[model samples]
Target: MSNSNPHRFSLESFRRKLASVDALPQLCVLGVIAGVITGCLMTLFRMLLKLGAMFFMPDNDPEAFEQLTPMLRSALPLLAVTLIGGWLALHSGGSRHQIGIAHVIERLTYQQGRFPIRNWISQWWIGLVSVLGGLSAGREGPAIHLGAAASSGLGTALKLPHNSLRVLVACGTAAGISASFNTPLAGVIFAMEVVMMEYTTVGFIPVILASFMGSVISQSVFGFDPPFQKAGVEMDSFIHLPWIAASALLIGLLAGGFVRLARSASRLDILPFALRLGLVGVAVGLTAFWYPEVQGMGYDSMRLTLEGNVAVDVLMAIAIGKLILTAGAVACRVPVSIIGPILVAGGAAGALCGMVGNMLLPGVHTDPALYALIGMAAMMAAVLQAPMAALMALLELTHNPQLMLPSMLAVVVACLTARQLCGCDGFFISVTRYGMHPLQQPLMQALSRISVPAVMERNLTRTRRRLSYEQASALLDANPEWIIIERSSDDKPALAMNAAHLARWLLEHTADDVLIDAEGMFDLLEIPGERLELAPIHLQATLSEAYQCLNENPVDALYVVHGRRPDKPRISGIITRSAIERYYRYEDQSTTKNR
Candidate 1:
């Protein structure tokens, strides 16, 4: 309503501010919002899972699928998969099936942080069904999917810039991991390493804040108990460190094998959704029939492995059987996560090694729980290609500052083995390897850093396609950069003329007192102007989008607008290839030279 109020609250101003590198304070606010939203969602999801567990199990323990009768245990996966597959089969279009961590990565890399509501809605039910049905699944994948979607949607509603939205997505990702595991430090590292794929001191502060908030919310509800418990874990000796590192190497190989199998199974995307799910479900059911330890999140089994309560033979069965089944379930697009199951498999492998070591060398002090802790770190680091995050998780979960040396050694060995010997990228990337690359090149990366709103020319005046003498005279007085030609009813502008040229033309035909008909006498229509073949891009768009619009169409310039809706977009500014090129060429030269 007022001049200063409108100017201060304008979307263009907000977007331009977001484009700067010093957007930490605003991002911290968004981080709080993301943390609260994701924390609440995760709490509800966990409660629902508990409620579902009450229907069949003795207690409300969702992980206790083993307590069910053999017939019910075998039938649950098949029945649940049928219903889930049928539901997914019906709505399987666009981004419906794309609902998990891999999908989250794909959207961030390609869609510029815009996640669809359809996929977000589907994630809630699909994730709930997976764990409740007795399939070897993890809740973390669904939690991340739900959290990232909620954060992205919040940014979208506020008309935030894409760069800001991307940061919000990272915040949601951190919140998801932190709330799920109560490991705030690990959550921050995981978001930076796995999702955002880049890190800076300015960018990480908000992420750290969001992770801490998520942990606080979860701690209020779930209390201080983590998924795994350990008491006073210490290394046996420096001599046994070699055996532990060797075990990490084996876990890395196993991780590589698991990823490869999942990738191979993902090729069955051609098959009908029901058939693929039915086949995987049958496999899970048959496995659950014999070894129910393969069902649910397997955190219970992981706890037992740490306590040395699980027998060696049963541990071997769970370690191998859960690996193959979980890999297949994920590859076939079960919409479940492998984070929890991977930890279980690693713990089981470590427990078996500890048994063998104690039997062979009777004089040595062998603590299998310590080995299990190290194994959990190694498996997570190798499988996700996130060594720092896994190590942080190990420290936070154990609450022991002294295990850093062994954890780091195991994580490094595992990561090296997976990358060098096994020839594997992280599982998320390996499965979704369909010709997508990050903005890695220096110039492109630099271009992507700032938003279009920050760089676009805002010193322009809008007018009708044809201007009268008096109308043109008044516009020239302002000395605007360009005059935009448009009609009130049209979606985009018609053309833009250089204000200098119009000013020059007006000076030459200055016979105002002679009563001249400028339309016929001067023929002002022949004035030089650039034809407008402009495409509509959002204020949140980066220079990468500007380049993309130019490449995809026969257009030289773009109109920067506030929103994506077709009917009511508030036109803000304009951008051109020359302007974009000059901005980068002048500003980035020194940075590029140093690099």
Candidate 2:
């Protein structure tokens, strides 16, 4: 058994510290562990994708879906959908089908970041097949899911506290993005801006460390090549700023439509799962039949757009076709990844805009590559409502600080257009609309960071339900704050009474000159003191959990215990509802004062 002593440097002690808000050192340690685990898993995940691509894709190129024959292009998605549907059918219950970034966010917000092993296993195969079969899906989404699950599993196996598990999940999220894209800074920003939805010094250090380690591991295996080629492109003149902003407005509108379409499509639960998937297969296959550029992640197409090689008409076609098809697939809930496709579509749209600008104003010297880069950032920011993460990604991917000025303009414009003009919530937020919002209340977030042991009252004594008058008098000598009346049977609940109340009763009986047998038994339940019903709660639980327990149970206060077993619980402390309220009230005051 692990040492439970708080003073000792042990796993239990480490977990206890993590339950507090200032456990930066401990969280950073866990961040490194999560990073290492996520990096290995992501490497394996990429290798599996590479291996699967080689089996069917020509020359082992994962993005060579356009090179396949039209027959194969149409048939691949059908085969993939049949397989994915069959795999899902095999485990047809609960949330086993929930896979990808939205699922990760759901677990973090509602389930204390405890990922289900079943969903993790499903994502591995489904993600592989989706890309290999040319489903227009991105690998990064599945990669994030895998990384977060791996870290959550690690925390679960170690039996770490829930607060620590939450941080581990965030670490894995950053590591996943870092490993998949080879962009550590962007990964860290994405974890904070998109997934965690909150940023702090305590959170940033660990996520940064995890993201760096993930990039290190990925680079060690993949030779440090970025997914996109270094553009070496810069804005030629300030005159193009107006055009760039105009393009951002259009991209923002497109992003809003994409989100709305996908969210509206998600409500089509009236259709059977198999039928919905089949429809998606047919739609993608038909689109691929004409425009093979729409197949797979379309990164190759994105590369061509960035190189300014694609014709304006073709770019427009690809931008529109990809946006519609991807939105459709997402609506069907086919587990198809959307990020890569969104980038490809946005880049195509931007390239088209640049071509149009060149035609309309010959002296402006418009560069399609620069526009493509800007569009990628703007669309991402608009769709995800994460401008900081998108901007970081744009800078890291291009390795050009010159793009920051234009990219910022585009990102802000796009986000404003999508959020205010189009009335669009972020894509992930739209999908997870039914879940409890992570930032719903300030007090709940505050309480979640504190453990029961931090606020629990330990000044109490446990005793049998019935005690001799002399025995009670002796117990009062210790001056405990409260007295616990132990249950006679396991089925009966434990009771607690204020020690002062028992002491007052003892004094009154002795002063009244009442005849009392020295060995007479005093039934604590029958005494004049008010007795409170107590329920058992684990020591690792947070104040939020204790509050939840009090709300769910009829008991007045919770008794903290050390072990999981119901029959042999080791009582450690007590926490009342008022204590929880008082703690948060004080926290609120402290925060106000600090400001």
Q: Which model scores highest in TM-score?
A: 2
User: How well does candidate 1 score on lDDT at residue 337?
Assistant: 81
Judged by lDDT against the true structure, how good is candidate 1? 0.80
Model 2: lowest-lDDT 10 consecutive positions: 431-440
What are the per-residue Cα lDDT tens digits for candidate 1 across 509-576? 76463234646233334666555556778777878778778789777788887644565556688888
Clashing pairs in 1: none
Estimate the Cα RMSD of every predicted model relative to the unseen true structure.
3.7, 3.3
Sequence-dependent TM-score of model 2: 0.92
lDDT of 2 by residue, 340-392 (tens): 88888888988888888899899778988888989999999999998999999
Give me the runs in candidate 2 sitting further than 4 Å from their true place. Answer: 1-7, 93-96, 431-436, 477-479, 486-493, 511-519, 526-531, 552-555, 564-568, 593-595
Error of 1 at 119 (Å): 1.3
List residue ranges in candidate 1 displaced over 4 A.
1-16, 93-96, 359-363, 430-436, 439-449, 464-470, 485-495, 505-518, 521-533, 563-570, 582-595
TM-score for each candidate, following the candidate numbering: 0.89, 0.92
Clashing pairs in 2: none
Note the Cα lDDT for every prediction shown. 0.80, 0.84
Look at candidate 2 and tell me the lDDT of residue 28.
93
- Per-residue error at 476 for model 2, in Å? 4.0
